[model samples]
Target: MSTPRHTLAQLCAAVTAAPVLLVAPAAVAAPQAPPPSTVIGGERLGLPGVQVDPLAGAPALPTDLTGESWIVSDATSGDVLASYNPHARLPPASTLKILFADTVLPKFDRNAVHRVADEEIQNIGAGSSLVGIKENLDYRVEDLWRGVFLSSGNDAVHVLSHMNGGIQPTVDEMQSKADALQARDTTVVSPDGYDRDGQLSSAYDLSLFARSGLRNADFRMYCATREAMFPGAVDKNTGQRSSFGIANTDRLLGKYPGLIGVKNGTTTNAGSTFVGAAERDGRTLLVTVMHPASYQRVYDETAELLDWGFASAGKVRPVGRLVEEKQAGGEQPSGQAGGTAGAPPPHPAGAPAGPVAGSAGDDGLGPVGWSAVLVGALVGAGAVVVLRRRTANRAGRLWK
Candidate 1:
């Protein structure tokens, strides 16, 4: 345990030499914008150093992905493996919950109980999904979480908002949390991801949010659950009491080995969106698609990405511990105050210049601030990102 001490001169020389090597690389390849061919929206998009094979045999990817944008990333490393117009604006449907889930998971008190409110059920209007939560009935916080992920209940989201105070306050908190996590391209207008007029998020942004969600151990467990049995309870309203089962909307569970929970979303306008994960051997993959053509499209597209990701060269192997711990401190969710700051400003809302196809952000900033805590819970994001960057390099392509 005794130290091999460095002399004063040795310390000084080590510091000086380190900067020379670090600064030299930057000076040689100054942060210049990428070329036009690589610029899709406005971001520099290319796998600068990924090792990809042009002739690598991959499953036939569907050209007509119903989704306007999609992404597949290595969950362990947060690297994008493949994408389709990932930055294009498309309806997120319930996938919006990924953000809400990330924002609210930190606020959860597993022992705290919550009661469904009348206002929570009011004004959801048409097309809203509900778990049929009885007004004035109380449930454990963990049960509410199941309702949110397994059922995709709009009412459950509203109830969470009520628990956090009110809808506007909850939405505001969610937005603030989003900015803190630095999901810059994401603008949230609803809690349950029911598309409102102004609410929007890019495929890249979803990837970032997914990355954040994977940070929570509790959250990860909830998402992976295929079904849950409701606690015995009676409806306060109409005195109609019943027990209901919550089933996960994600189709990939059990179908794919090593698959875990995240969330799934769909709406008429937003089409179908899915965020799911799987660990094969040790490597994990996070796959997401927004506004897919049909229910099956989400499944097929995700499968394609997973197939390509596993077969890609230099695929990162998952170890016993989570990857963030090896590189950063704890995996902080959206609300955490850790991560690199001075990341420049975010892309202004409606900035006509869009991000490049594979470039993380078109706003000139690199890898927007994300809570490692969130990424850990949603382990898929880290794994996906890790593999994505590697695959991108091989393809001479990159994705946000």
Candidate 2:
């Protein structure tokens, strides 16, 4: 089923706050001004933005974007603030490790040491990113997580999987944990986000996983480190002591304030994927992108969204200016925005509760599984039915 047919206003209210359902005695017809032209790449395109209100007369959303898919979210609340095709599934590549980290971080003792097993390196070869883990070398779980995030180490995933149990069981746990987190559109075929046929995820889910990652101070530290040292030995073959120096690929950090560590991923099939976060003014933003033309688009677009978020302030408005009368279910004055004196300002239309951006679509390459593709649709549809019914029931009781 498609997303539940909530008006933009209703959706914001439902997701962000309860609606005040009193009917207005007189419904004054408010005129809708034609939407303003959108600004794209600093040029007005003359394309009309979606009209959200009549009284407040907010301008159109900027159309500047280069990513095929993206999401920007409030890291603290997991509220998606803006999205573009959020539910679309795409190859997540190494970004899939975000889910892998989520499952592994809580189970392992960060300070506990994991012996790099020969089996952990099984079938993993030179082409795959590695932490230079010499066979039988011991490394702390904390370092492993860093290698996973910072180095994009497939071997680190394998080590964690073995520590968690066999690879199959770790994959199973990854799926279970993703489901529990309400990341329905995500699936893990491999512990590391290697390009496997059945593996896929959406920007929406990555944002969710990134938000969860932020909660772990250890995990956050792993992502932000530009470089780290793991105590390990020399390779016998070359008689060289392999220095395992890892740098985070997430480009947004340091360049952007409140930038936090997430992860970056790319594969022959997946193109490029990124899950990143930044904080400023007590608000944190989660940004995720998949299948972009180049890795830089993910970072550039994310920086742009972060800048937009800072310019806006929480404004409590009068009811007429708060919501569009036509879209207000006939219960509010026309074209008026309203809010209680101390209530948090309601986000505008097109403002999602999670990422400031999100995307889903065919990566213009090949077929993705229908089951994986439908996960978001089914979840959204199902959630709306359940929530709306419960909301209606409660509304009925309050009326009586």
lDDT of 1 by residue, 1-400 (tens): 2333656566456545555432222212212333323222223211121212223354444455566566667766665556655556666778888888887878878778877767877877487887767777888888888888888989788888888888888788777766655455567888888878878876766766776787788878888889997654665687765777778878887787778767788787777888777778788777777766678888887877677677763643221111121122424544323223223332433332334543434322233312221232133324434443443343332222
- Cα lDDT tens digits for candidate 2, 1-400: 4467656555555534422211111221112222322221111111122111212433333466766676555665444445565556788988888888888888888889877879877876347787666667778888888778778888888888888888999999888777655565677898888878888888767877787777888888888887787666867798765555667767776778878878888778888788878777787777777776676776777777666544432421111110111232324344333222222222334433222111211111112222232332334545534444443343333212
lDDT of 1: 0.63
TM-score for candidate 2: 0.63
What is the C-alpha local distance difference test score of each model? 0.63, 0.62
Tell me the number of clashing residue pairs for each predicted model.
58, 33
- For model 1, the stretches where C-alpha displacement exceeds 4 angstroms are 1-66, 232-242, 315-400
Clash count, predicted structure 1: 58
Query: Best-fitting candidate, measured by TM-score?
Result: 1
